[model samples]
Target: MSDIATAAGGFRYRLWRGLDPLPSGLPTGFAALDALLPSAGWPAGSVIEVITPAWGIGELRLFLPLMQRLSQQDQYAVWIAPPYTPYAPALTQAGVSVAGVVIVQPPQPQQTLWSMERLLRTGACGLAMAWPRQPTPRTTRRLQLAAQSGHSLGVLFRRQHAGPCRHTLPVALSLRLDAAENGLAIEVLKARGGGQLPAVTLVWP
Candidate 1:
């Protein structure tokens, strides 16, 4: 005998449900983009892996809105081994409360991962971002678990072509980004409906 578990009301799919009712996503500050996402925004308490060809590239802009909101809520926003110095003026322009933001530049990539895990697992921070050199399958899984354990948001940034391994990682979401003249071109490699989603264009205001 099997229990019938379903989500999205009528649509039924054999999927493992989480311990709690699915939490709502944080608004991504873009209406069109949010509508495209299954969760309507960034999935909370899960690891989101983003692959980009280069650093900057408006990638920080993509999350700045969310970070601003998190800061407004008085939640800790931590950055691990950021590729560039996070300018205070830029953060202020983005509306992120500079006070609530913490940047940790560990001497080693391993230490960066360790720091992210602790912040996520302890719920000490509402959001954590890390730039990993090359995360192993075991490492990715550990980060995922740590975020889910405390209902925190974890974002792992990596360079493009650093993938192929992305398909094997246990992240809740995976997005490949290319810098566009005006914004970003995102390919949803993996998301709610499973692998194989079309690309979308995101323009910043």
Candidate 2:
């Protein structure tokens, strides 16, 4: 059987019936933020869009925990064009195994997205994260399809002020991050199964 078929046949996939069910596991980056996320974990086989006006709006921090958690599950976490050379020490501090993290440098944002999609389609990595300079609705839809086909998690980080695309993404949720005095604030702009909700603030350790 193909890798995709194997993933779909796995117990986790069966439990959720192909689509990811809520209340999954998260990384160990932040305690407070994990509490606010649905199912206290990142949703597999879904696309999560993270937007921020500034680079240090705790966006990386938000994903650290999720990465750490996924790493512990013996799954690889792939990062494309990460803004900063992920401090392996910092990742270790966050309880993530640096060994399981794969960093890829793509020539352009579009290439990065394409690489991410290919990885998601392989069902190899547990999670894939990318920072795309420009993301269209159509591109996101393709990513969603890839995630579902491979039963993997894909996250897209985009600029905060960018306008919505003409098409709609197949993402389960679209979140915007804002820096707060205490930590980071998350605004759920759009969601699929559930409607939008007020912005939720979370503190980072």
Quick one: best TM-score, which candidate? 1
> Taking the candidates one at a time, how many backbone clashes does each contain?
0, 6
**lDDT scores for all predictions?**
0.81, 0.73
Candidate 2 residue 191 Cα shift, in angstroms, is: 1.3
lDDT of 1 by residue, 103-151 (tens): 9999977798889999999766899999988787788899989998988
Question: What is the model-wide C-alpha lDDT for candidate 2?
Answer: 0.73
Q: How close is every model to the real structure, measured as TM-score?
A: 0.86, 0.78
Worst 10 residues of 1 by lDDT: 5-14
Single out the weakest 10-residue window by summed lDDT for candidate 2: 10-19
**Top candidate, metric lDDT:** 1
Residue 163 C-alpha lDDT in model 1 = 36
